[model samples]
Target: MPTYPLLAPPPLSSGSPSAHPPSIVTSLVPPMFNAQAEESPKNLILKKVMNELDRINNGMNKSITLNSPTINDLEDCCVKSALNCFQSKVLYLSVPDGKLKKLQIIISNELHKIVNRVSDCKPKELEKAQCKPCDSYKEVDSQTFVQNLKTLLQKIYASQP
Candidate 1:
């Protein structure tokens, strides 16, 4: 059998350098992480991305669309796009991270609370807001339709194995 310490995990000859440390480093190396630091291009790239996102989020002007003649009448398109982006970007429970489950549970419970709040409302309340009950009713029916389609797709995927 091969020895440890001086071996250095075969020098990572693979193209992607799949890490395969032979012996545990915790037993050998000192507890200082700063001494083992390497150049992390990913950290630099992530910092740049975060800076760009911050700039975009803070600098975006809604008045650009508001003042434009073409989009002035097409405000509904902008609203729909914003709502679609929100829905699409929601990190669902199916994500690999455990924290997403907490967020999912919180969001699910909050939506339930919102629905419960509105469930006992009078017809006049909806009418005053110019909101029809049928507006969200259609969305609910469509959501169910899409969910059923997704279940069918899951079944097909399972059958492939």
Candidate 2:
């Protein structure tokens, strides 16, 4: 019967001075497997969702064209992008125990608050030189909506296994 070699080669003979140093042996061996290197599918999906959310947040931070767009117009853009993100990405994410669904509802409610606040103000009120809403909305504050969303997203990402 033929005998097979061991899975690992026998240790190098210590008597002879080796041409290759011990560092060379360490370098030749492949690095240990890292769980983080292979991100879960859910993690990848969440990353994409967060990226879209960041884009929306960044867009809101910049001052748009100075052509005097109505507050409603700006709010509408934010709302539409948010809804699109939920529909296209967040809804389909595979999260544990319906967490993604819960997040969706929260985001939707916040967007609605923004929409209602913008709509409540009469065009004339906005037209007046310096009258902005006192930033009061019972459901959600539009001014801090992006920050709140980011916080929620961070919590969700950290909860991932």
Candidate 3:
């Protein structure tokens, strides 16, 4: 059986000049953390959804712009694209470490919060800003954000086996 808490080089071949096996220094190596106990994707998403529901109770607390603006007026598409690209380029991402759903929820919540804010409504429960907020967001803009987020949520729901 192999030894524990101690190890040394095995004996050399018959012609080896050195008689002794190399001595190994004993040190307490810290136990490496392989991973954390992560929440299931569905549960995590549900928690966010439920939290938003609780916070709103009846309806939004922030003021929403009556009629959100047009593609040309409401928000700068260029800025959105630039930020998206910049973040993708700079963010440290790895498969095992990626919080994909959390990222999606945080971003989606921010956009929705922007809409509600103009309406004079309360931000969603998950409304805490985690990243740069969207600039020039308005209430009377195209309904793209709502539709896009709805579809994305649907896709996420359907994608899970």
Query: Model 2: which residue pairs collide?
Result: none
lDDT of each: 0.33, 0.41, 0.36
Candidate 1 accuracy as lDDT: 0.33
lDDT score at residue 141, model 3, on the 0-100 scale:
17
Tens-digit lDDT string for candidate 1 (11-78): 45453445664655567767755865663443333233334333333323222211111112222223
How far does residue 72 in candidate 1 sit from its true spot (Å)? 16
Off by over 4 Å in 2: 1-31, 35-37, 61-143
- Model 2 TM-score? 0.34
- In Å, residue 19's CA in model 2 sits off its true spot by 9.0
The candidate that achieves the highest TM-score relative to the unseen native structure? 2
Worst 10 residues of 2 by lDDT: 61-70
Point out where model 1 deviates above 4 Å.
Answer: 1-96, 118-121, 132-161
Each candidate's clash count: 0, 0, 20
Q: Candidate 3 — which residues are off by over 4 angstroms?
A: 1-39, 50-57, 61-63, 66-150
* TM-scores, all models, native as reference: 0.21, 0.34, 0.23
The lDDT leader among the candidates is 2
